[model samples]
Target: MELITSNTHQNQIIEEDHVIKKANGNFIEANTLKVTLEHLKNECIIPVFSKDNESTISHYEFVLKTKEIVQDLFPEFSVSEPDIRTSHIIKGRIPSAIGKPAKELKEHEKTLYYERCAFVMEIPEVVENVNGNKLALTIGGVRAYNQENLFSKKSPEKFKVFIGFKNMVCTNLCISTDGLADQIRVNSLNQLSEAVEKLLGQYDRNKHLGMMEKMSRHEFTQSQFAHFIGKLRMYQFMDKTEQKQCFPISINDSQINTVVKNYYHDPNFSCSGDGSINMWRLYNLFTEANKSSYIDNNFERNVNAYDLTNNLVYSLQNQSSNWFLHN
Candidate 1:
């Protein structure tokens, strides 16, 4: 698995040209917030009005403002409206915050845990045929509750930029997890534009597609594919060892197995006889698996599942020959 770092690492790689520097010079926090709120209204996620004993106020939160800035950079993609259709309810709890079920606390002592919320913006994809197979650059992102939140006065929300592939014909989301950290991250709004540019660079380079192209040239027998599945299952529940601990995320065995099953058995994954052993087919299988596990309002669950699956795929892709041979 690739070492994941915060988004700031990207600025070091690409030189800050005059355009970005000039934009930064022109950045006015108050004006930016105003512009961002207008964009949120465009997407129909209105700001909430709150009246408390101390004061009465109406304002947009950090999450909504962050969304507006992101949309401004990528005008081509449409923001999924922030309604039930786009929302996810994350499960689980911090044991320390809320004690075991057997214990009960006073009403005022109850903890406040809001459901995890996320938004995904669909990027336009560029598809190409490689050795009679399809390859694409699929891009999207996730902003959520736990990683970064509204409580912090200076830094209120967490935003992640992601890249994946979408099979043109079948429309399955093909995700390659190689260098996962360098591809996604948490960032401050000041670095938002630069971060978006870096992600766009990945899409332009066809980073994931290049890997798939090489894999497509190789062949995998049925037994080898099964062995790959076995490895993923193992990773699904493996303890967090030193080298393998990059992103702090986990997915259970049942969820992992379900995604693997759908990859091979689902009609969307069906390929021509010649397509059976190619890498694109394998990539599609796993990406398909990740997409199939979505549970409404289960934001954190889906995010963890996607991260774990991506890590497994990244590990497998990094040592394809060794893994394929051992199996």
Candidate 2:
């Protein structure tokens, strides 16, 4: 199916003052405006997924509110892309052979075949042929794993995400945006619970899948932050050093430490300064570990320190994947 996507933004808030103004006349603040948008947009997508596709594993729809990460992934959606590209949905696949989406893979069944059930993204050259909104992903082969669906839309929810106030006005009615959004603060309570639920369900169906592996803060850093895994011994996996030959290169740990320590003192070291690798991925791991960055520079330095490790880590990750799935 060819899915057409478009975006729109304009000023329609001249009357919003009276409707959304505070007692002081400043306007309702950013969060309030954002909450309104979230409710409207979510209403559109969730319904579509629920009604349209019966087997949808998960779904999320929202305006690409953040330019920081969106622009990096898709240059076309650069400032304009992430800034304007609104609404998104992600549905898991139903377990099936290469050509269909019928058999749903249960999570427990997946764990039965592979050494480990890991998530890997695929950098596909052509996207339309792929499922859902995932850029792409690699299912570490285990029969049920490959046969299991990671991205699929079983219901009509596929379009629910696109049915928002902005979408209705901008895309459908061809109207403009209002100034309200600027003042309204929103949150990224970006919920993927449905998706996670499917993953958990899959684990349950397949007895071998077991529960999702709960890595310690250290194990998390090792897995998500590639560069860190090969060098940093966050925690001793399996009593011995988790020495896996997946990563082929060795980095200068002293250099890495210097880079991070030096970045800490630099004023300009925001997360954006990490020089592109897996900054957000690293951030997630640390967040999993319960770390936060109050200062912009520290954020970038730490993220870069974590991202720079992907090259080394993914190698091992892939190698382990090979062991999990037969070539």
Candidate 3:
């Protein structure tokens, strides 16, 4: 972990010339819609705190503050519009009448507010080329209903923030534990900003890039690939004790199934004509499947994908017994 100091601000900025440009593509994670910051500020209704409850930062405010901090920190980078996912729609009458049943209210009488929300932001200029694919720097946050107790007095509200790389070829975010602050408890925007900055400052971009670049050099033969897929499926049914003996896999069986399908069909990451696939391509197959994950689980699974793939690389380099790779 890198120690953050007063010079952190100056140390964080890349010394390259500023080349402002939008990210080449959009990031539409599962169940999320692309929305502008202005739309979030103007159209969404902020949740009201109960009489005994202290105030907490709103989703719009959180996104805005985080964006401002990133802009200030990386003046040369261009941020994309936020991709937001919302749920548990709260409805009320436009005129604010009391004790009206749901059936009594017409469509026009209904006002709306989302009970939970999550969003992601991409910075295009702070990017690197791994092999031939462009991986851009990305940051995001999750504000979910389960993270807070709405009826309680002033307490720290929990939020999740991550800073990582987004594969521009497929827009699949590559994250690791170092890049994620899974539980940032804060009562105010200033605290949240500090937490975000801390996570960004601690992230090791060169190390991450080196890991991905190394994956490009290792390959899995046709038979090894088949055995790997079969083992993953079988691992899903193994008893908890049995699972503990093997490396942990963060993606579910559904995602493993997707990986199997993509192994043969995915245009960019599929196996070559001789039925051999490099570890980097295999890693991406997992991330492509991860796109189906819900917003809350998305970042976790992405981090896991990197971990699992990196472990596979370790197993290959050391000739260790890896259940997924060995029979």
**TM-scores for all predictions:** 0.51, 0.17, 0.85
CA RMSD for every model?
Answer: 14.5, 23.3, 8.5
lDDT per residue, candidate 2, 60-83, as tens digits? 222322222233434453222211
* Residue pairs whose backbone atoms clash in candidate 3: none
Tens-digit lDDT track of model 1 for 50-165: 22122101112334543565467657765543221122322343456475562555444433222232233334444565434453444444433444333334332344544554
The models' CA-based lDDT, in order, is 0.40, 0.23, 0.76
- TM-score of candidate 1 on Cα atoms, chains taken together: 0.51
Best by TM-score: 3
Candidate 1 stretches greater than 4 Å from native: 1-85, 89-126, 130-138, 175-190, 202-204, 237-239, 242-252, 271-276, 293-327
TM-score of 3: 0.85
- Overall local distance difference test of candidate 1: 0.40
Could you tell which candidate, 1 or 2, scores higher by TM-score?
1
Candidates, ranked, TM-score = 3, 1, 2
